[model samples]
Target: MKNASPRWFTSSYSENGGVCVEVATNLAASHGTVPVRDSKTPTGPSLAVSAEAWTTFVAMTRH
Candidate 1:
């Protein structure tokens, strides 16, 4: 992920009174991971999960 930056965004379905997490899936292909962070703290530390793990997590949430 050379020269690439995280493009964080919250899901459009999120409407829970400002309590949401942001995710940057844009780096998944290049970095093999997805960066996640709290929406209220953009400058805080982010957690990076493997691309496959992130995919599985989202799919589970849909069910």
Candidate 2:
């Protein structure tokens, strides 16, 4: 939904001087996807990743 508001946030592990991506997982359940965007440009475009893909990525990062 274009009207949907995404709550974007970076991971706690991000310590590279703000050079990291922000993800809005809040809409995953309803939209079936995770919205990712650059922290430097909140007004810019975002990438919508499938929930499954997001889960896999997180799992890999945890390893």
TM-score leader: 1
Task: Estimate the TM-score for candidate 1.
Answer: 0.93
Off by over 4 Å in 1: none
lDDT of 1 by residue, 1-63 (tens): 286899999999999788999999999999999999999999999999999999999999999
CA lDDT scores, all candidates in order: 0.95, 0.91
Ten residues in sequence with the least summed lDDT for candidate 1: 1-10
Model 2: per-residue lDDT, tens digit, 7-53? 88898889969789999998898899999998888899999999999
> TM-scores across all candidates?
0.93, 0.88
Score residue 46 of candidate 1 by CA lDDT. Answer: 96
Model 2 poorest ten-residue lDDT run: 1-10
